[model samples]
Target chain A: MTDMVMYEEEYRQIQEVCARLHRDANASAVLLIDKNGQLISEAGDTGHLDTTSLSSLTAGNVAATGGIASLLKEKEFTGQFHEGEQINVHISIVAQRVILVILFDERSSLGLVRLRVRRASDELSSVFDSLLAKVQQPSTPSIFSEITDEDIDNLFKD
Target chain B: MSFINYSSREINCKIVYYGPGLCGKTTNLQYIYARTNPDAKGKMISLATETERTLFFDFLPLSLGEIRGFKTRFHLYTVPGQVFYDASRKLILKGVDGVVFVADSQIERTEANIESFDNLEHNLYEQGYDLAKIPYVVQYNKRDLPNVAPIAELRDLINPEQVPEFEAVATTGYGVFDTLKAVAKLVLTELKRGR
Candidate 1:
């Protein structure tokens, strides 16, 4: 059976790009999600991370914060900047369907992450949009999706 | 000529700490932050509810020096462990690499620990990542707790596959680095095989 999760390969590709973005921008973590808020991929240390939960939270934040932005008649929120004493989150939605969330410490600047992400968002959307389209079209299976009891069994046996 | 250019690099990896509630996932990152040298880490962000529970997640970034020419860094994250937050957990696991399954060692929290582990596997399958293929580790935290579960039982229940495991007291900073080191090593090792 095909794994229901979409964007695995695309997200994998994006992970590399996000890693570069994190290093270059001096940010903490970077998250990329679909418009529906399904997480596609991420970069940074996940040693203490439960990203499954974080992606939804980030999408929700974007939706709620975006609504407030619309109501306030501010520029529709392309992103959000939350400043804290130690850590901060920069939330940006790309191509309206994907949201890019950046986690950074005080050493990283909101200005820097925002600047780089604006460009990264567009680049990422273009790349992912194509990948999503590819997944929709081919419907071909790769060794990756060949997950089965045997696969799990053999892996565990090792 | 800026020494570091944010736009230059292109690869990003997202990792989430999967564990039961109050298992010190957040505390692990907190301890890392306390010890991390400035310039290597960015801000730490927490999304919390009025009750102070981790409403969403805690995020932090750490630079693991450099290997070869490319810089090896990690983005640390913690999910809200409450069972009701399953949807949130599902979202964060969307795209992840190297997971540190932080288990609460308290005997009473055993059920929570097991449930979360199952949830972690389920979520990964949904994301199309076989737990075996991804860089993985287990951390039996709260070693300092007086009523903690014995390490043997904890190991059997959670670390059955024995990818790698650590004993920790995240709140006091013990075992935090060990856990990070283990995961970082796994992530890098993955680069060798997959990259």
Candidate 2:
């Protein structure tokens, strides 16, 4: 199992990348979702959207696509764009661990979204690569080791 | 995979509920969704057939307060358990942090239980995850029904490794939270050990 620990600096960097993607692509929202369906960061308009559910479903979609890729003898689908009558979702795989999902309506074109996502994905990939390196360092302390059983029990407290 | 975000001070873990078809996997999620505080849970999503049988999966995102200032969020997923949905089941197991094997307790489905358990092992292995290394628990669901197998029999067959196991009737919420808590606890312990 790989541990994904995102420190403040890395989080800020990812936030900036997502914000830039939202701005440059004129997207409704941009989300950085882990391949396991956790939301790492978000930017732009997500007020009404259920980003949590969206993130989970997005990762599921990516996994299903990956299964198909394997069946076809391809590595994986690094980029996918789904067009809708009004809304569109563009997903790009980053560092093979995280997914960048850009949600847009008629406001943005697929060509522009793809172009911006390419740049943003590269930036996000580098940031996450470094993050993974930091997590992998042997010297990094285990955050859970210090917490007591009581602390864990308290989490279940109402 | 477990994700810890220092910026938000949150730890997110993925827990997948797996078992044979009609083993009460979805019922477990539904019970949790109904009983949990609204602030602690996100909307439940179910992609199911018109008859309400799960087609792809059911997802429920839950936040269990905070541990050492970091919110502990758990994403619960139930894969489609029908035999023909093997591909879908395999996809759902990717990156799973913990697993709850919800076995049907009825004696008539003994073979189905064994077959599904084997399928779970094979699918996890294909994803490069060893079942023994991952935090796992077993739930003997539908215990309220007649002709249920004895707890010892179920344990011997499905839980030979002797990880935490619970008896549950998910529809009425009996033992539902107990099963969830047991698996969640193991997941946290695994995290603490830096797994």
Candidate 3:
């Protein structure tokens, strides 16, 4: 797998899409996580949630479901929903690289969330396409390129 | 695969702990979680059976301070090490930036260690990551046990690549951070080289 490098331009674009989706779907929260369980960006009421754990667990759930799909000779199982008394979670994979999660309660219905996510997923995927191109440019130097061995050692220094 | 977010000035990498059953993979993560400052770590999540054996994986997200202006974060995961959990192991290894193979060092567990090592290599190969190319380390755990094998013997058996290896009693936290720091450093060094 190639490293995922996000630039400011694409990040802003992604943030816009998430924000719009959150508003349009009337969702309580929205999160975009990489398949490796890294939180890329999040929107809505996330301050009270432990997003780190949520991202990791959601990725694990996706990975496990993907495994099950392969066993059945399918490419992947891209969408999952978990309903609860007070909340509901809608999860889907975008461009096979990142997960899109929308959490809603009585304020939003499943149909509305799914409809808004379908549009947001396409927008996010296009943003990622451009981001990937930017990352692949050889002229773009890595931030770590200037780091010295001393820097790494100092991190371990107590 | 590492994720670098310029907007957030954050760098996140995934490191997986792999080994055979009851080999202390989970224990190693537990020690780190308990010892880390609350601000530097998120909640530790263990997807385990009622008996506490890991049903899927254990996850711990840690922030290892900063490198340059970028905040360095690592999501550590421990796969269920039981022999029957091969599918779960492979799933956890996906997108891994580094690996720590926790070997059960007890003499009778020698064969299990080798089998698990081979499994690690095979699973990595399936994902197109060469065992030699990836940032990897070995930890011989259960060193406090009286029946444990010699470190030299264990190294020769599982670590022919001469990768950094540590001796540890995970329950007591010996060599735990040493092993973590070694692999984390290797991962960052590899990232630098990739550029």
Candidate 4:
């Protein structure tokens, strides 16, 4: 698979989608993560959470689920839900490239979060499509292409 | 695959530690986690069995400073090294940017080392990655053990590609940072080459 490159335009668009989902779903927090476990963006009350660990574990969960799906000869389990005592989590894959997660308390119901995520997933997919197109264009300069050997060595210097 | 977030000024890469059961893959990560500064590292998560063997994987997120203006973040993972955990191993190899094969250095475990090495290549091939193309390094761990094989013998069997290799005793942290730095350097260099 080719590298996933995120430009400023797409980033802002993703952030907007996540923010809207957070408000509409009444989620305690909303997180968008790459399949590789990188946190792309987050919204709402995440200050108390360990979002980095959450993103990594969520990606692992999706990957393991995808593995089980393949074993059963199914396509993939595109969405999953977990009900907790005080919090509920709704996770869905967006465009097969990123994971969209919604964490809601009693303030929201699973039905509302799922409904809101369907629209947000569509918007996020389209934004990612444009981002992929931009990434594939030969005219788009890669940041790595300009990095020098000295620059790489500098990272290991201390 | 690496993820470059220009908007966030960060580059995220995944590096996996792979080897046979009890080959010290988790120990390598544990040592790194113990040594890293709080500000530069996140919580190290280990999903393991009740017996303490890795069940799925061990994940540690680290910030290896910056290059130019972009922060370089690495998500380090260790696969469940037991032979029966092949399915879990395959899952962890997904989207790996680099690999470190931590071979058990004891002579008795030679076959297991070779088998795990072949498994790494086979799993990567199934995922469309060629062993030769990826930034990879090898570590002959358990070097402090009395029954360990010679480095030269281990190299002949495991380092046919002549990839950067190190002798490590993961428990005491010997050669740990060297192995980490060598692989991380190769990974960054690979990134610089835009692959």
Top-DockQ candidate index: 3
Question: Which residue pairs show backbone clashes in model 2?
Answer: none
Off by over 4 Å in 4: none
TM-score of 1: 0.61
Q: Which pairs of residues have clashing backbones in candidate 3?
A: none
A47-76 per-residue lDDT for model 3 (tens digits): 999999999999999999999999999999
DockQ of each: 0.06, 0.76, 0.91, 0.86
lDDT of 3: 0.94
Q: Taking the tens digit of each residue's C-alpha lDDT, what string does model 4 give over B1-195?
A: 999999999999999999999999999999999999999999999999999999999999999998879999999999999999999999999999999999999999999999999999999999999999999999999988899999999999888999999989999999899998888888889988863
True contacts kept of each: 0.00, 0.82, 0.92, 0.89
- TM-score for chain B of all predictions: 0.92, 0.98, 0.99, 0.98
Runs off by more than 4 Å, candidate 3: none
Candidate order by decreasing lDDT: 3, 4, 2, 1
User: Candidate 1 lDDT, tens digit per residue, B5-57?
Assistant: 12232223446788999888988988999888887776677887887688778
Place model 1 in a CAPRI quality band. Answer: incorrect
Which TM-score does chain B of candidate 4 obtain?
0.98
> Which window of ten consecutive residues has the lowest lDDT sum in model 1 chain A?
A149-158
TM-score of 2: 0.97
Candidate with the larger lDDT of 2 and 4: 4
Candidate 4 global lDDT: 0.94
lDDT of 1 at B169: 90
